[model samples]
Target: MRQVIQLRTEQLGATARTTLSARSALAWALIELQRHEEAVAQLRGLLPLVLAAWGEHHEAANGVRLHLGTAHFASGRPARAEELTRVVLAVYPVMDGLRLRAWTLLASALSCLGRHREAADEYTALLNAASPVYGEDDRQLLWVRTDRLHQLAFLAEHDLVEQESRALLAGLADDDPLRAAISGAHAFVLNSAGHHAPAETIVRAALAHHDGADLCLGLARSLNGQGRHEEALRILTDARTRCRQSGDTEHVSLLHTLTARALLGLERLDDAETQARQAVEAARTHHGPTHHRSLEAATTLASVLAARGRHTDAREHLTHCAAAWRRQFGPHHPRTIATDAELAAVPKA
Candidate 1:
């Protein structure tokens, strides 16, 4: 099925170089394949062509701009991405898909830039609009609302909002896949905020219903939060196998990163370092160096180096992390602040 989709996408690309829908489809395919840099490049090339063909104010042009912004943001060029997205939002009031998508991307870009307050506002607006359009009971609306809750939880560096969001999401029908995924993510947020007991329960239930690598990854994370390092390692190992079996290299690389964390928790410093490096290499191959997944792997590798007392190497990794975060989220973003603090705390050799 995946191969068939890939072939169709290739044929579409060859058949219509100037068609906006064709370019958009290709861009989405690249993103799903985790070829973020390639996606960004394709969108950049396509955007100007779209603008020329449809003019700046045309609805089709606005759609291309939204995709272009998202591609840039995913590729770690958040400022450029935000600028394009802002233009779209400023021009279009309530065009179908435009407002919601633009606000979502804008919020993400703002969060990366370290403007958490601004990002929070964007999320709030998105939730408000999405709720009206899809209603709170709608599965798609619940998913959008859950994403906003995640952004809020991250910005606040707390889980109260996340817990509340999970409660709401849990009330959703068990048959809804999107709700199940959101519940899994909510569990992860709770684990990150140190609410392990409830998180474990939620994640385990979520894993039962959700077969995606992300759900498995979240379960592993929650287990790690509970100090069940061995369990976490086993879960990640299973997730890695599943990803490989499914030919999902991106998730496979992510599983490697989680394995590195679990190894670190187990005090197996050497193995942790090895796993972290492997994850970084794999993520770079799949998503390129500037991608969020690659940077996350790089950060994990640096943390492992720091734990091993390799101060110089750790500092280099932290430097890369800081620069990447700055480029993708801006200098003042909470995530950037956290990375900067990590970099600053490295012992001088």
Candidate 2:
């Protein structure tokens, strides 16, 4: 495929003038093949040709811009995607399929930007417009609802999370390929709502087929919530291995924290301390000290240290964690209040 693309590009470029159409074809092919960075580079190089050929207002020129926007999002450059997608949507004719696609890209960019409210609004708009055209039960709408469900869970809107998750699950067949994923998501909601036993059942069943990172994590959490610490530890050990091989560093760190929690439950204080410390250090290194993931990792470590009777160490860690939570989430934030409570439990020097 690379050779074929190169041959075509060379044949096209050998002419006195390159046709943006031919170049766009190659760029589109690369994007379709999931070679996003290559597509971005190809499109960028074709930019001058595109502008020269279509004079910016032509449909072909706008098509290149839209494709480039999608490639930017696929390549994990959400900020660039946000900029390009907005440009296309502004002129891309409202109520058209192209405009709707631009909205999808824009919503994805906003979600990755941590602008959760904006993302939710975008998805809501996308679904509202889409349902009128394609109806509410369209398969394409599942991804939008799943993304919205995650946002609701993060915002502590648990009821909405449950509602959306179940809605998604209901749309799928019992034996559908996506059933395991949906079941895992629903299990997460149940676990969050304190229905640990049922969450465990759902997650365990999902893991029997799916092997998704989310399912693995959910299973561990459900087991932990039910005080089945040994089972959680056993599951997380395998999960860490699978996640490591898949190059999911964040999940590997999460597995460590979950392992620490399981170890703490089993009264394996020393090992719990070791695993918790590792999780905290790795999360801070990868996600930054003030990042949400880092705070979560640090909290696990503080819990382990306190449980292990290292009160001084726990006090110091909790104090630092509390300050970070206050800075990131504010004093009135749930996370900050929770961290403050942990810090208050430690005896002062």
- Against the true structure, whose TM-score is highest? 2
C-alpha TM-scores of all predictions: 0.69, 0.75
Write candidate 2's Cα lDDT for 1-349 as tens digits. 5455445555676461346687888998999898989999999877656655445565666678878988987675777888988877676555666677778888777765655567778889889878888787766677667766665554446677677767678756656656766676677667756788988888777666677777888899899989999899888878877887886765666778788889999999899889888988876555446555577789989988788777899999898889977775568655678789988987766
Error of 2 at 160 (Å): 1.4
Q: How many residue pairs clash in each candidate?
A: 5, 0
lDDT of each: 0.74, 0.75
Where is model 2 more than 4 Å wrong at Cα? 1-39, 55-76, 94-98, 244-250, 267-295, 305-337
Per-residue lDDT, model 2, residue 45, is: 79
| Candidate 1: residue 128 Cα off by (Å) | 2.7
lDDT of 1: 0.74
